[model samples]
Target: MNEFTMNDLMVLMPYAPIIIVAVTSLLAMIAITIQRSHFVTATISVVGLNVGLFTLIGQITGVIDSGAVVASAEQLFVVDSFAKFNMVVIFICALACCTLAYAYLANLKDNKDELYLLLLLSTTGALLMVSAQHMAAFFMSLELLSIPLYGLLSYTYMRNRSLESGLKYLVLSATASATILMGMAFIYAQVGSLAFKPISLVLGSMFESPLLILGAALMLFGIAFKLSAAPFHMWTPDVYEGAPAPIATYLASVSKVAMMALAVRFLIDSALLALPSVQMLLVVMATLSILAGNLLAVRQTSLKRLLGYSSIAHMGYVLIVIVSIGAAADSISSMYMAIYAFTSIGAFGVVTLMSSPYRQSGEADDLSHYQGLFWRRPIITAVMTIMMLSLAGIPLTAGFITKLFAILAAVQGTNWFLAAMIILGSAIGLFYYLRVMLTLFKRPKQFIEFDVAGQWGIRVGGLMVIGVTVVIIYFGVLPNSLIVWSDMARIW
Candidate 1:
């Protein structure tokens, strides 16, 4: 009995980082009880996340290769390779955001400490979402992630636009949450079990019933809403435009990744998603999102809004490989997701650096703000160009490699039509992405001296991300190490 307990402990060892973060969050909250310092809280959070990231790396090889890690805290969570990978990604985003926020929020007044607390708690929620194995755990984690976002979006409490954005998100998210609960109730009624693996066993047999189909559809709707896919993405532009740049970056990068990771886990693990109708639904959604997102982005005048639409389109590309799921294609989606996460972070990091805390009311919008950026911040301008090019699927960047994988997976699925649309969409996307790049080089009406402050941390982060972009492109050209790694990690 003692041997069995020790073995279980070994399997569950990798998730200690998550536990540490949660504890550290509580400690920060307690610190607030005595005194309030947002920078100090952010410092503590960054340190914790950095330590956690190192610990996670230490455990990845052994745990992922030959063993599984599952941590149960009152049976609400279970961490394994998939969850751990996502948690690491989330932690990296969190660390960068904290650094950015330290600079971005230094000027803001009111509830700054509370903002840091909310951010940490929300991250914990996202971590829980990735690890949830049952319906109750799923619903709780989803709420934990969303509820904090409502506040985070409106952190600039006195601003009317920010308040409006918060209200819009709160209402829509509440409706979506209700829809998810109804679907889950139906699922429970049909399967008599709320656990994922168990429900998956009987999902196919239950699909003939309308209740099951409706439940699955509703559930997809809710999750899709979370992902900011088109048609359900009305809230994104407003939220992104109203929120501060750092918060916008968080939503654009880490928040979306966590939800996508959860979606991947569900579709792959839950056998019900294999039903023809479900698969077709997903494929159609991906197709429409790719087409519409690029087209809509072409008309956006605001930088944040354009990126919001661009993000939706990127999610569509990720969905292409996701819909083509099979043992032969798993690595395609994972690698694509990794590159997407990195590029999004880099892009948003640039945005945060460019934005002024005391800028215009709608600072999140108006691409004109980037006018003459090249003359002011040459290095970041170059980095942003690389990021935009990568996002547009240009050669010699991470985005290009990821898009190649998606296209390959789509071709293997025999969806030549999807391949064609992806090609066409990439063409349309290039115009908008390049339009911004052109702005960077454009000669402004007056030689404006933008008073942008320099932070070495951001510069270092941006350069590191650009270096990664170079490697991503290099791998595309060589097609050796990345392919081998993907091949090794591939699982149905």
Candidate 2:
């Protein structure tokens, strides 16, 4: 076999969409530094994402036409059907986030230009993460994907909660990073290699080694924290409640989807998910997350916090894909994740539009704030209604289809316990979702009027929410296109 070389790395780097995004971020940073123009900066960032997205499609088509999975020198990254599909979703989600951030930040008095820069940087990090094929790359990608979030979470400096969430995420994320590093150390001590495929090949009879399993478990612990799964999900609601609405959207969608992709890649490439110990651990986490997420959201009066808790359960549902083996499981998981991403965007986009940036009393995030919304703002009411229905997995929404996919995967894997949890959790989730819908028509609360309906920022955000809501309904009615696409994509 030919040896890995610097020339190969240099030639291959330009082929990845990550380079386009990274360069765009650099250019945006330069423009922001020269002149603090929020519109210019935001435009630059969005356009770059669009370019990166197109480049990604072009790259994938070229690779497929050539019928090859291209890994850079030293196998640090690989572009397969799975990477292609997930990366496409990441780009799309990031695009939506960019527009949402634009609308949300337009009303801000803070330095809005830098927030877009951080967003571009974070998007670059996520792209790097999804295609990582080596432990070193994975560890580096995790940090790249997380560090900018620390800044974004706290971007609204005037808000105490924003600052608090930023600090909370900083401390917790650092600890998680350390845990991941140590896990990598443990695995390296045994395998003497950090490339995923190599480790699997070298393990052979030693695949059941205590140290290896311990390392895998540690890594999963850190990842579960990122996914906000069950016991490790305590930080999720706090962060969601504290951060600005669009920032919360990024956390719920882009960050969640990227990590899930990496986790799936690690399990599949290392062949570790097949192990009984890992499988049982995953099932337990899945069960707790589903039950805990749905149960906790039941009592939430804060909409953002409720969605945060709800995300935990949705992630648990996504985990069903990880522990199961075969193409069907992978496809179903991707479908669920994509639906979750779009649903989250629509949900949070509505919140961002409804909440006031300069409200002395703070954002209009409470359930009472949305009560009787249908009387004053029928469009927002309809948008939020669809979001709630989708989140609840009601029929005629994309969420219902995702639930079906999860059930099929669970039964296919013979995981009856998890299948039962899926059913129970959705049943429990429906209660709170319907409660929110009821509030929309009851009586408008006299708390504090956000009165943002006339603002330009609100208009931009409102349109996006409506567009996303329409798509959700469309997919709910006809999911065959996405289903066929999912079947076409796979890691190998």
Candidate 3:
């Protein structure tokens, strides 16, 4: 029998955030059984998430002060600067989502307390994902992150779209997971290892093997599906349209961020990006996603769907920086993803806040729903406008800075094609984004009554809107701080 060592315990310390969330989830479930109260459960969830976030920050600070930390469990988990950076992003997004969910779930007719448990569990999975250094850990975390989403997506089980979305996601995600597992099996059979570093060490020698290449391709396909990149993005719009607003926000921000971090880690740490075939695949996918996403979004009347398509394009842009993995790639990718997360949260936060409590449909997601929004909810309208502008890459907004960073990364890597496609995509994106803005300010053909009556949830949501708006504008004006921070958070 082996005794536990200090290194083993130290390795576990970085996982405090995951541990905290998991415990809180169980406690929340127990509390739900003891007494079912939405406010009480929400309070517990929010407090737990906040505490988890703080723990994550402390771990990050320790890493910064001391050095990178790796778990003693066969080096399968690590808390390097890369992991810390992504964990911080995931925790912040989770916290914001929990805050938004408090209000969003308050008026729902269904049993809502359990949603928080799922949220915490999903976040725990995401935390595990970004820190996963081994393929086995990666797959386990992927399922953990995904399984809860099915419940969260179809939380409003009575609605037809909710049911459809959940079923679609469950089926598609299961297929993707199986594909990934197969790929992992193939790679394991060939390389005889599940850890990233060992596989990387042997990849060069086994580079010519058809099984290895096939495995890599399948894994990339699965990852691309999760990221909703290009042809694999078919499920995105339907899921976004059908899911509750807060859940949609979680999907767009938290889930994507975690997956992006994992994808980057795999590509870089495994040295898989060195292969020309892999590079070409990424480039092709990025190009198609950029062009098709923007083009398809132009005709969207549903704001949720529009944003879904926009996310596809945004991820394509992120992929551009990812493919150009150089000295600046990781920093640029982090900055780009951070800006996207904040702006996306702000965008969906407005949508979540505007969601009518009495509507059976869940959220008012249509273009007509927001017609003359500026005349009614000016603050939400302003926030939405900022987010849209940022998404469009307009100057003096975080989106513009993020786009510039991506373009710079492409230029630095001498990837002229991707740089041009990014510019083209941004230009195309502006039309739809500006169209939404125009609708917000348009004169209503007839006055529609709104429930101007406020609630605690709404007021808190307004504060979140204000907070995200300020961050967007601040970063847009003084981009240096975030840029420096992103640089410090480099993966490799």
Candidate 4:
């Protein structure tokens, strides 16, 4: 066996963000034990996340200057342009979530310091996931990302809905995990190795085997559940409705984005995209998700639930690009994800800020709650309107650009069916998105009191909304830079 030495440690220097986040979680736990000050814990968590993000940026620069770097751990972890790009997006989303959570959680009666700890852990898990190259690492990192979400989802245990949402997600997510594990076991049995390269080598011979096909389908099912695609997306609206606005935003944006990135990596590296049956299955899922998500959202009154369905549809659009993996797929998918992240965060941030902390009743999530929002809060209403428009894929918005990119990719790949599905979905999506926008501008029948406890949090959240709004508009208008960046992010 090779001797373990200090030099081996040097190889992990590029993974400083993951290491920093893990260490920060430990520190937060200890700090919480000593003095359970939410502010102190929040500060520590924010600082740690910023440090980790900066470290990741530095690592990326170093790599660009001196080629890609593989971790010392036998290539189980990789530090490449693709990993780095997705990590940056994940980190930004995590940071925004942290900032939003600080304000949102401060008014809660319970001890909220541990929420930051869970965020750190979950972020660390996301970082690990993007870098993971082997099956063991992938599953471990997936759990690391998921386990913390269970706690975060139910952080407001005082709410019955939160508890119910947590339980539902836990059960479904566990079932998916078990399915994935079974699939991985089946693949390993046939290939005798769990690494991507070796598995690809054997995939040709194993392609005709029923066992391999079943295994691949199961694996796809598990990933689809995480993506909240149709046929496995029943959990989405309930969870989004029950979870706090910030947590819902994280789920819709950060968590889904990371999972998609990993899926892209796995499919490309393992050459699993070569399977005809798999492609057909994905096409079906994408088509159904697009139709089901939009049709369901059209009838929803709850803004959170509506956005949940909207996410499902948006993810369906992304899947179209994923299925059409080609020269432009990476750029299109990345741009689409980035735009979605910005819009989702902005939309949810508005919901989060509008909520009343002292009320023991429902969140400010109903469509009626936003009536005459333009009269009450024009800036916020404008931001929300822009977000909704983006989601609807309207022109002069990031969503439109991204959707166009997806269509272009589908056409380039000769997936005319998927291209048509996207157009139909976008047209259907416009109705609900417009409904929300109209509600924002409608005159209220009665004046409703808007109460928020954390002024500082409101300011921070507002700033985040403005920031994301600016980005959405900027990219929607001039998307060249983002397009170039996404093009640079090659999976293999």
Whole-model lDDT per candidate: 0.74, 0.83, 0.85, 0.83
Which predicted model would earn the best lDDT?
3
TM-score of each: 0.91, 0.94, 0.95, 0.95
Please list the residue runs of candidate 3 whose C-alpha ends up more than 4 Å from where it truly belongs after superposition: 1-8, 62-68, 71-74, 326-328, 445-458
Output the lDDT of residue 327, model 1: 33
User: How well is each residue in 1-492 modelled by candidate 2, as lDDT tens digits?
Assistant: 144575566456534578888889899989987999988998898899898788777766664232234564358877677877888889988888888787777767778888888888888778878788899889888888899999999888688888899999999988888888888898899888888877667667786899998998888989999999978999999999888888899999889988988888887787777567888889889989999999999999999999999999999998876675443455678788889999999888888887756664567788888888888778778888999999999889999998888888888888887788899999999999999899889977776476446653345566677788988999999988768877745777
| Residue lDDT tens for model 4, 1-492 | 244554455666667678888899999999999988988999898898888888878766664232225533236778667887888888888888988887787678888898889888988888888877788888998999999999988878878888898999999999999998998888787778776667678888878777777777888899999999998999999999999888998998889878888777777777777888888878988998999999999999999999999989988998899888643465567668878987999999888887744455768888988888888577788899999988888888888889988898789889998999999999999999999999989997486855334343347767887889988998888878778877767766
Off by over 4 Å in 2: 1-14, 61-69, 72-74, 326-328, 446-448, 455-458
Model 2, global lDDT = 0.83
Ranking of candidates on lDDT, top first:
3, 4, 2, 1
- Model 1, 292-335: lDDT tens digits are 78999999998888888888888788877777754344457656
Report the Cα lDDT for candidate 1: 0.74
Better of 3 and 4 by lDDT: 3
Displacement of residue 292 (Cα, Å) in model 2 is: 0.9
Kindly list the per-residue Cα lDDT of model 3 for residues 216-332, writing each as its tens digit: 889999999999999799999999999988899999999998998888888887777877788888998899999989999999999999999999999999999988754346667
Give model 2's clash tally.
0
Backbone clashes, candidate 1 = 1
